[model samples]
Target: MSIKSVPLPDIGNFKDLPVIEVLVAAGDTVEAEQSLITLESDKATMEIPAPFAGTIQKVLLKVGDTVNVGDLIVEMSTQDNEATQKPAESAPAPAAAPTPPPVVDAPARSTTAEPASPPIPPTPPSTAAPVNAPTLGASAHASPSVRAFARTLGVDLSQIAGSGPKGRIQKSDVTAFVKQALTAPAHSAPATGGSIPPLPTIDFSQFGAIETIPLSRIQKRSGKHLSTCWLNIPHVTQFDETDITELEAFRQSLKARADKMGVKLTPLVFILKAVARALADFPRFNAALDASGENLILKKYIHIGVAVDTPNGLVVPVVQNVDQKGIFALAADLAALSARARDGKLTPEDMSGGCFSISSLGGIGGTQFTPIVNGPEVAILGVSRSKMSPVWNGSAFEPRLMLPLALSYDHRVIDGAEGARFITALSRSLADLRELIV
Candidate 1:
C-alpha cells in the first residue's frame, strides 16, 4: 500500500475557504468520489470528494482551517497502481471539483463530541458593522459564508462570541445575534434615525403548550431578502381583475394538443406570455434601478421569474427570453423548472437574471394578494384564483371568468399612473390572445 496525499481541487476562483466539516478520520476507509470534507465559501458550501478509494491514514486539515486549491487535505493509503494514477489524471481538470448544490434547509454535521457553545450576548444595533470592518477585529473566527451573511445584516462578528467548535462563528450564531438585537428594549440605541422599535416579547407557553419550530434555511434566506426589499422600496400595490373567459376557452381547445406534446398546459403559461408582451410595451416595468439608484437599466432581453412553491420553501426560477417563446414552450419550461424546484435540484443559475416575477396562487386558491417586489427587478405580478362573474358588455350582463391580479412595484421606480397602465396592458393581453401578437 502506498500513502498518498489528497489536496483540495480546483474550485473556481475561490481562495481561503473555511473547512466547515471533516467527514472522515484516520483509519476510515472511503470510496472514490465520497465526500471527505466540506468547505464553505462566501457564495456556497462545497464538499471535497475523495479522488480514489482508499483508507485514510491521517487528516491534515480540521474544521476552521482556510484552504485553497492544491492545499493538502488528507493522507490516505491507496491499494493499487490505479489509485495512484487517478490523482495525476484528475488533479489538473477543473471538473475535479464538482459544482456545489443549492444550500438546503439542513443542519450542519458536527465532527467533534463537544457540546454546542451557549448563545453569545447580543450587541447593540448601533455597534453593528460589516464583518470586515476594523471594529470587528482581524482575528474574528468565521468562514467566508458566515462573513458574507453577517455583512448582509450589518453585524460585527467580533462582538458576538462564536458557538461552533474552537470558537469558529457559524451562520446560526449571526442570526441569533441579530434576533436579539432586534428584540432588545425600545430605549436601546437606534442604528439609524428611522430604526424600528423593538416589539415586546411574551412567554406564550405560560398559557398554552407550544412547539418552537425553527425556520428552514431557504425560509430564513428569503425572509431576509423580502425584509430588505420591503424596507428599502416604496411599494404600491394595484389590485385589478382581468376577464380570462376567452383565454380559458382558448387554453381548453389546445389542451388535447398540449397533452399529445407531453406538456401540461396551464393558465400560468398564458399569463407568462401576456406579461412578456406587457413588459415589451412598458420597458420601465422590466427595468431595474442601478446601484446608485440614479439610473434605470433597461434589459434588452426578457427573462421572467415564476415563483414555485416547493416543499422546502418558495423558489423563483427564471425563464429566459420569455418574449421569444411560445405558449407550449413556456408550458414545458414551467413544468421542468417547477419539478426541479420541488425536487431541490435547482442551481443558482436557474434562479438568476429575472427582469420581472410572477407569483401565481391560482392553483391553490386565493382571491387576491400582493406579492413583494423582488428587488433588482422593479416589479412583480401576483395572480389569484379566477371565478365566474357577471359583467355587462354595453347592454346585457354576461358570465365571464375573471382572474384577480395584484401588481406591486417599487414606487421609487414606477409611478402610480405607470403602475395602473402596466397592469391594464397586462389584463388586455390576457383578455385577448391576439393582443399578445400585437
Candidate 2:
C-alpha cells in the first residue's frame, strides 16, 4: 500500500472557498467518488469527492477553513496503483490573472476655487491610549455566501450562535437570528427595518405538560425559505372551480390500461397537463424575475414541481418537460419522484429548475386553500378536493364534478387580469382535455 496526499479539485474559478462540512475522519474507510468535504461559495455549495477508495490516515482540513485549488485536504493509504501513480491528478491548474478595468480620466478640477487655509500641527501620540475597536461580524466564522446573506438582511453574524460544525455560521443561523430578534420583546434589541411590536413570550409548560421536539432538517430549511418568500413576494390568489366531469371520466376509463402499464392514473396528472397547456398560452406564468428583479426570464421549457407531504416534511420534486409527456408518462414520473421523496432518496437535481409548482391536497380534505407563491417561479396552483355540484347547462341543471383551484401569483410579475385569464385558461383545459391537445 502507498500513502497519498489528496488536494482540492478543479472546482471552477472559486478561490479561498470556506469548508462548511467535513464528512470523513481519520482511519475511516471511504469508497471511490465518496464525498469528503463540502465547500461553499457565494453562488452555490459543492462537495469534494475522493478519487479512489482508501483508508484515511489524516484529515488536513476542518470546517471554517478557507481553501483553494491544489490545497492538501487529506492523506490516505490506498492499494490501487492508479491512485499512487496520479496522486496530484485532482489538483487544479493555476488560475489566470484577472483583467484590469480600463482606466478613465478624472474630470477637470475647478480652476476658480477659494484659497487654501493654513494647516494645523499634528498632536504627539499618547503611550497609554491605544484601544482596540470592536468590529461587528468580524469575529464570526462563516462562509462568504452566509456573510453576504447576513448583510442583505442587515443581521450581525457575531450575535448568532452557529449550529454548523465547529461553530461556523450558516445562512440558516442568520435567518433564525433575525426571526428571534423580530419576535423578541419590544424593550429588547430592535430588528433591522422592522416596526411590528414583538409578541410576548410565555411559558407554555405552566398551563400544561409540553414536550420539546426539535424540527427536522427539511422543516428548518423549508421554513426559512418559505418565510423569505412570504416576506418578499406580494401574493395575489385567484380562486376558481373547474368542472372536471369529463376529465374524471376519461381518467377512470384509462384506469385498467394504466394498471397494465404499471402506473396509477390520478387526477393530478390531468391537472399537470392542463397547467402545462396554460403555461404555454400564458408565457409569463412560466417565467421568473432575474436577480436584479428588473428583467423577466421566459423559459421555453416547462418543468413543474409537485409538493409531496412526507413524514419528515413537505418536499417538492420537479418533473421535467411536462409539456412533452403524456398522462401515463407523467403519472409514472410522479409515482417515482414521490416514492423517492418519501424515502428521502431525492438528489438536489431532482428538486431544482422548476418553472411552476403544484400543491395538491386532494387526497387529504380541503375545500379551497391558498398556497404561497414559490419565489423565482412567479406562480403556484393549489388543488383541493373535488365534489359533485349542481351546474346549470343551457336548458337544465346537471350534476358535475367540480374541482376547486387556487392560483397564487407574484403581483410584481403578473397583473390581476393576467392571473384571472391564466387560471381561466387552465380551468377550460381541465374542463375539456381536448383543449390540451390544441
Candidate 3:
C-alpha cells in the first residue's frame, strides 16, 4: 500500500468557519484517522482528520481563514507508505531544548497561556515540558494552512511541551507568544565596538506619568505606515444619515430563510451587497485615482475590506470579489473573519489588499465618528449604530431606522462634490432596498 500525502481539497461551505486550532506541526508523526485541526464556522465546530497518517512534512495555510471545499488542507506521508515519500530527516531533534522549554517554531500551535502584563524574557527551549501543557486534540483540528502558518512563525507544538490537562494547546498561549514576539525587537544586540555590551543599544524604560508600552513589530511598522498616510493623504470625512427603514425590513424578512439555509445574515453583509450594487452606477467611487499622477486606474472587481478591531489593534481584512457574493454568504464570511480578528488569529493575508473599507463601530455604542482613510484606497465607509430617528416624507414625519454614515476619502482622488454624490447614491441604494433584494 502506498500513501500519497495530499492537500485537503477545498470542499464544503466555508462561509462561516473560523479555524479554531491547528493540532500538528510540520515533520511531526501523525497516526491515521487522527485529527489535524479543529474549526468553528457558523453552526458547529468540525475537525479535519488524517486519512492516512504517517508524518506531517509541510503545511500550506494558516488559522484565521475561511476554507472552501477542496482547499488543500495538509500533505503528509503515511507510516506504511514511506517508500513512496522522500527520505525522512536522519535524526529527529528533541522536541525542546534542554531545560526542555516549550518550542517556538510557528505561532500556529494553540495555547491558552495569557500574556505577561509586563513583558519578561521568554523561556528558552531547554526548559522542562510542562506535563499539563497541552491537550492532544483531534488531528483534523488544524488545517494545512494553519500548520503552514506555525511553520513560518517558528511555532513547534512539541516544543510547546503541553501545559494543559492532557497537553492541549490553547488559544491564549498562541496569543501570548505572538504578542511577546512582535513587541520584542527582532534585531539582535549590536556587536560591541571595542568593548562593552554594545553600550546597551535599547534603553530599558524608566518610570513616568506615561508608562511606556513596547510596540510589537507589526505595530511599529503599522505606526510608520499610518503616519505616512496621514502626512500624504488629504482626508476629508463627510457624514450623512441614511434612513434604512426599508432596508432593515428587507433584512428581517430574509434572515430567517437564510438561517434555515444554514447561512448567516449580518447587517454588513447587506451593506456590502448594497455597496457593490451602488458602485456600478457610481463608477467614480469604484475606481481609484492615479497615485502616479497620470490617469485613473479603474478596477473592475470590488475587493471590500472589513475593518476588524482586535486586541492588537484595528486590522482590515479584505473580502475579495465582494460583488460576486450574496448577503448571506458575505455575512458568513464576515462572521468567520470577525471571530478570528477578535481572537488575534488573523495573519498578513487576512489583513492586506483592500480596495475599499467598511469600518463598523455599530457594535460599540457610537452615533458618528470620523474614520481614518486606509491609504491607497480612495474611500472608507463607517457604519454607526442604527437607531430610531424622525424622518420626513414628502409631507409627513415618522420614525425611521437611521444609521449615521461617514465617508473619509482622499481629496487627491475624490473631490468633495464627487464624495457627496457617492454618498447620496449609496444612501439612495440603501433606502430603496430593492437593488440587492431582487
**Best by the lDDT measure:** 1
State the lDDT of candidate 1 residue by residue for 1-438, as single tens digits: 788899887766655666778899999999888888876542234667788998999999888677778889899898767555244234221111111112222122344333333443344655454322222232477665566566666565666788888787787887788778768764555444224433456999999999999975566557655655766678999999999999999999998999999999999999998999889989999898886679999999999998888666777878989889898999999998888677755644566678999999998998999899887788999999999999999999999999999999999889999999999998988898898766
By lDDT rank, best first, the candidates go: 1, 2, 3
TM-score of each: 0.72, 0.70, 0.55
> TM-score winner among the candidates?
1
lDDT of each: 0.74, 0.74, 0.59
What are the candidates' C-alpha RMSDs?
Answer: 7.2, 13.7, 15.2
lDDT of 2 by residue, 226-266 (tens): 65476667899999999999999998999899999999999
Q: List, residue by residue over 1-438, the lDDT tens digit for candidate 3.
A: 333654443323233244556778898887655667666432123556665557777765567654444455667766563433221211111110111011112123444333334332332233323222221111223433444444344454333433445544454444455556556544443322111121233544543345568864335444544544555568999999888888888778997898797877767887887778766666666666564545777778888888776555565667878888877778778887777666655533455456788989988979898877766667889999999987787799888989899998888788898889888878887888764556
Off by over 4 Å in 2: 5-24, 31-51, 63-73, 81-197
lDDT of 1 at 142: 67
RMSD value for candidate 3: 15.2
TM-score winner, 1 or 3: 1
What 10-residue stretch in candidate 2 is worst by lDDT? 97-106
